[model samples]
Target: MTEQNEEKPRNFHEMELDDRILKAIAKLGWQNPTLIQERAIPLLLEGKDVLVRARTGSGKTAAFAIPVIQKILNIKQTARHQEIKALILAPSKELCHQICGVIKDLTIKCSQEVRCVDVAPQVDLSVQKPLLVERPDIVVGTPTRVLKHVKAGYLDLKKSLELLVIDEADLVFSFGYENEVKELMGSLPNIYQAILASATLSEDVKSLKSLVLHNPVTLKLEEPEIAPESQLTHYHLMAEEMDKATIIYALLKLHLIRGKTIIFVNTVDKCYKIKLYLEQFGIPTCVLNSELPAKIRCHSVTQFNQGIYDIIVASDEKALEEPGNYGEKDNTEAKKSKRKKDKESGVSRGIDFQHVANVINFDFPLDAQSYIHRAGRTARGNNHGSVLSFVSIKEKPLLEKVENRLKTGDNDSIFKANHFKLEEVEAFKYRAKDAWRAVTKIAVREARLKEIKQEIFNCQKLKSYFEDNPTDLQVLRHDKALHTVRVQQHLSDVPEYIVPPTLKGMGGLTKRNKRKHDFRSAQSSASRFQARKSNPLLSMDFEGFSKKKKKKN
Candidate 1:
């Protein structure tokens, strides 16, 4: 493994790339290559197999995408006929779709010469056969999906395949696609140039490197996994398990944590638990988890990037530290139903969350790597961000692990004490309970069921989900927690008395400022809805809520 961190200044024009590729990069508004792209692109273009260990949001996708497309174009120049030459496999379906989109964007100028298709194994195999039948120059899908197609005779890649890319390589085995990956590798032509790109060098990643790369030139970037101290801030608050809800309630309802934020929780149920508790006070939030349909998950991310919602409660990180949601060859016994976690569907792993200003860990992550990846969502692209975690007495050990990971770097400790006193917002405790109380267990169950039905039965998009599991009985096990978030408009407003005392010193952010922020958030949501009527995904479930909101007014 080679280590290279020297970032010599270089631009897209400096690299030996095709004119059409350079033109597409300009259209995407990329002024220069990122450090990872600058270092790895030249090596990949030279046909050197690479094992890349870089953090997320480090432009790693384009690090491989640009070279992959350049090679496809290079092949097309001399080859007489087109064939499936490149295969890109990601752990989750969402990541697969994202890579496909990025590849397509880069191939805009040379689309006629290079073809790419992103497939989701979660979807019915029959539906994707046509996309595979075309024999695209590049095929992007999960290892499971790619293997299924190859076995079904829909995709013939035993001979002409030349390039293989496994993005998010650490997550491949974690998602329980190890068997599929091994089988797919056994079928592929062994002479192809390969790239195993991952954010971390976990045991699984090391195992994959031995299996995938061939005398590969390793590039372990010198950049710290965590952002610089100047660009981001970290804070920790000690709270009892029972009062955890109260702390987050005070933070958001009092306008303490400002800007677009992502609140992270551990279980799928917790995602809804927080969203519903906030919703009881007329807060608008979206729930993201693995159990949800792929379409809904993808659309939620698109709307979030577009600023349709400021707060998103997501169940990720260790939420995906379970088995992949595939293959029900075993009998439907209670023990066998543990395969509910969708390895490919995680918000924390990689989902392209743009301009996220804050990441609040409602529950601390299970491991150091989970914390690192969750933090990766924010402090992206020269933008400043903050992560505030609620640490309970029991969670102190988890907190220590995260702190120790950061201690190896420049400053000793990154996690700071809570800037604001919890006593200042003590008056809001009863109100927080009132809101939290309304999020009954029954409500969470209904919300979970309704969410599944809305995306599955209503949209009929869970072809892969249903195919793997014989019944929805297993959903009840993991989705036993969650809440319906719509409520009266009066609950949305923050009463003047609920303002914390010491917090007033920070820009005089009184109750009025909180209201002002809410008003602006609402205005943006309404404006975005009016601007794009054709995008119904963003507008889903708003009509009924608006009617009730108007009645409350």
Candidate 2:
């Protein structure tokens, strides 16, 4: 076994690596080993169980990937048919894909055949089962999905599995996968090596040491103290709830944050609302939330990475939820379900947005941990980034909690608090208000139109009426056109009406339209109808009047 105190290699070239892997390293432009890589790679290559604590973008992926690829290559050279030798579990589909990509890239120059498969919830089990049957040498996936296959016999992990790597171990535990991870560890052969890597070593992760890791060499890399403090500057601006959106717009325009920027909100509704509000300023933005389809979410992230859009409004809603039982069974007696739903999408953990220039917490985070994760998205690996938070007056305590978390007794806290005067943002507030009204009106109108269309589709009588009388269809089309034109007009001018039709009369109408229809008259008419129903004399008089009129004639 390699000694942890041995002198570290200066660069990848000096390390004992296959020539092909060295070539791949050169291709990747990795001239020297990062601090974590220097400390971890050698230990991993020595066939030792290692636990690494490092931050994002510390070259942790390559540290494990290179050694794993080398091991897979050596195994492939000996056998004609490859079996599942290595399994890497990540917390999310995005991270799984990312890890698989890195592995594939590193193995590109290997002489022996090294096949990798990404088993994620997004991929159908039917598709994955066949791929597993083909016996890929490397499997990267989330815990629940991977465990499901192993338990069902689609994936054979008992015989040939040589390595189990749990990337983001803290996150795995945080995501409530401790039971699944323990089950997996128990199922794997006793001879295989395991490596766990994470940023923060919480109590939950420390507890896992007894279960999965065996005499693991722990490597805690000391980060270099860059001059002039951290690469991230944190700021908090105090504003009212209504002024937050305006302040965000003002800050973006004021600071000219046109580079790849992420605005993190608390809820899914806020995600789309912020996106729409920003769009009203002619700033093209994309949204990422748990409710978006998997394909769209993937595409959005890809495009953001490719610089298709400059801004992404994302929600931390899913991240804030307690990770539930992600496709685990209650007991052996319970019948097995065929498929399980994928974990909810979130931007908090294990997501690396490269070159993120700015992160704005459009809403204050739930707690200190949430704040830390949100800030982690930026200022990664010596890169300079800025975090601006919108804090309402009532959220001062939450802000203080975040500040106290980041405070080292000797140094100033990370957050620089500031106040915005009403006079300073007054004009911008009006403009933002107009934009907000316009955007919200448009959104409401579009949603109402969808509901109307669905209602029409479901109404058999309406369908028959439209089919029989094509003129009614034309009238409906004409109404749609008129409504669209009205919406366009509302974009330029103040909207006369903002409420959706479904919600129109439940409350009183707006004051401007109160004169158009007299509520008093309608109330009086209703009262008269009720009075007539209650009065037997009125009914008797009507019958007597009819009889007397007939007699007189």
Candidate 3:
């Protein structure tokens, strides 16, 4: 067994990498090796299967990528048809594309030709089949797509496949790709080297070691400290469920969010709703959810990184649906099953969001692990960042659990509690309320209109009648009810009010007493109804029952 703590290389150049590869590293302005790079690169070059546990932004991508590129370069092949030497599987399409980009960058100056293909949902499989036929040296993709290609005979991994890399291994298992991964491993050569890397290795990943790796070297990097060196500030604010949107709006209005910010929610519905609410306030934002098309999701991330958008409202990638081809089946049960699968995807893992200045937990995470991942989005690679969580009264306990996990042995609190006074944003609250209501109303109306349009199109008689009576079509187009909900006035023009519900002293009343009070109110109403039914004067007095009867008559 090799020493786990062998003398590490001082720099990339000292690692005995090809001069061309060294030039590419220098071109990227990397002066020294990151800890993970320095440790993992050498062992990987020595042909050792490694299991790595390192925090995000630790240069783990390059740690494995550099060695893979070098190994491919070292292989001397004279055959016309090159086989895939390395297979890298990521949990999401975004991560797959990202890994491919890193590999391309590292192989820029290599003398030997290297063809890297990214097979993901965003790229058509039919298109990828031809590329696979070109005998690419490296393939980076999501597990499902890779498996699909392998099954379709478009990809040949049974022969000439030497190395297998699983990035974000914990996420890969959590996303329910264990079966696909197992199948891929079964198809590969038994003697191939396997590398699994993740921030945290859960029990599932630990169990996977016996099946895939043969006495692999485990590298567990020290977890990054939460505060001082990372310059990450944590703030937790309490707000009512209804007031959360308003508080977020106020935070934005006060310029509290500096630089590119990501607001994390636990559900897709909240992700879109918050996005619409923020946009209603004239804040331009994009939504990153699993339900979105692959191209749009990729474009959203690209635009965000390019500084085209300042704010992005995203759901936890785990809440998104898995990305792949489900074939042409439109059955109800199949659709429902697909939806359930989508809610379990872990798309957010392994994605690199460059220069994120802040992360706001719009919806408090269910557990501590989720909080850690959300906070990991910011404070990456020596960058200063902040995380603000919108904690409701009921969610305080969950917040406390996260705080306890983040605490070092010392008694000092890692998360600071910040009070968000309602009075400070009283005016903005009402405006936000009205804006949300108006947006929801418009959405409902549009959905209703779509149903009506579909019904009309589906009815053969109605379609022909409308075609014959063009004037009726014109009248339908001008229907006032169809356009009832319009953005005639801005939300800022809405009136403000303080209407906090009073729940004081409610606990003092027993259930029996509440039932008695309800009974008395019901008796009084019955007596009044009996009096109105029997006496003409009583019926005519104030109730206006006689007036309604006379109008009907």
Candidate 4:
């Protein structure tokens, strides 16, 4: 591949793109090009293959998307419906929809001339056939979905396609889509320009580079994997398995963590465990793990982004051990019957969780990349965000390993000890223990079952049918509570009498109206990383976490 670097173009106008494209950029309020856009756009417009490594939320979508739209617009002016001019492949269904959405936004003015369709939905081929029949200029989907379309005679990337972009190239391999990618590449027209955009140049990404790129210009930016220490503050709090719930409950109840936030857990079980555990304390959360269906997962993110929910409990990455079973959350007969990981279920990496203020690692990430993807969810687009990880005693080694990978200078660990000591929330001890006890293993499993069942019926095609037949929807509705968690209503409200002095001014953001008022007032106060610090944990003695405690087993 060609190893030449081009001079940076300061803005979108400098790239000599179509005027309509520039107008759309202006409409979107993009005053200047991001580093990725500045470097990658010009090369892409030049019709050269590019392998880019930039941080997430760095406008990577627009970097390749702008050129793709511009070229299609230009072609539409002269050519008679240039069918399938571009194909964008992502790792998950959520990301496919996201990329397609970006393209549609950019083509707002040119929508009539240049159309894009997301072929990643888990709907029937017959359902999507009409859209594919129109032969959209831009088709976005995961590798398998795109290949499925090609095999089913719905998409024709072998001839008319002029550009191919593999967004989140690293994840395509990790998701075990290398074979689909290779097969898709072989069937594609060899002369089409390609762009491989990813956060890292992992072995998989490099392999993708060799397979698709023709003397591609690799753009590895000097930026860090995550936002800098200033924009994104990283903190790790030590907590054992049992007390993790107690700490999270106290933090959210007292409003220590605020703004739109995502709590990342390791296993699918942990996603529900923290979510259901918090619910016992009257904290509501949306679960966005791999167990949920694609349409529901995507809708959950959209709703979360639109401020419908303040918190989302999600699993960040794939399975660490087996390749195929990666991100596979359940081993129940229903889940085991289907070998495919939730095609729509993904959070980190490609799917954008907009304006996220905080990322709490409820379970310390299994790997460094998982942590990076989780961290990338927040502090995006020049916005300030924070990461607070709960590290247990044994997980300290994993923490060190993650910090080691993040080291730029000697001994410069990116994650530091969280200054917020768990001790200050001692007032909530009895309540927290009471709440934690109510969250049983049965509740977690029940929560998973209900989520899976509801989402199964809520899938796009079925939902459409149910929309016309509303009574059927009502008939299939789950009326019963998923779990028997003895939710104590008093746990939802923090009485003013017990309010800690340090956290006094906020008025414990428990009440909805008061919380909104306090939230706005707090936002106006220039306290972005506000209220993180608290005193040390008063007692690990409450549970089996104490060293003096005997082994129950």
**lDDT-better candidate, 1 vs 2:** 1
Q: If ranked by TM-score, best first, what sequence of candidates would result?
A: 4, 1, 3, 2
**lDDT of each candidate versus the true structure:** 0.74, 0.65, 0.67, 0.74
Rank ordering of all candidates by lDDT, starting from the highest:
1, 4, 3, 2
Deviation in angstroms for 83 in model 2? 1.6
Candidate 1 least-lDDT 10 residues: 536-545
Of 2 and 4, the candidate ahead on TM-score is: 4
- Write candidate 4's Cα lDDT for 73-109 as tens digits: 7787788654889889898888888888888878888
Candidate 3: clashing pairs of residues: 321-342
Error of 1 at 372 (Å): 0.7
Please give the RMSD to the true structure for each candidate, in Å: 9.4, 20.9, 18.9, 6.7
Reference-based lDDT, residue 11, model 1: 85
Q: Count clashing pairs, candidate 3.
A: 1
Candidate 3 structure quality by residue, lDDT tens digits, 1-553: 3235657356888898988789889887788888888899988999999998888777889989998888888784455557899999888888877788788888888635877888875455787788889878999888899999999899888889988998888777777788898888878987898888888878877876776788899988665634342367687778766788887775554333446788998665565567556655445566666665454455567666655556787888452233222212322233454332232234346777876777888877767777777887877766667788888876778888787888765786677566555665576777778766755745644534443444334343455786688555433211112222344324312222222222223221233343332211444444433432232111112112112232210
lDDT of 1 by residue, 62-88 (tens): 999999999988898799777999999
The TM-scores of all predictions, comma-separated, are 0.84, 0.73, 0.75, 0.86
Per-residue lDDT of 207 in model 4: 93
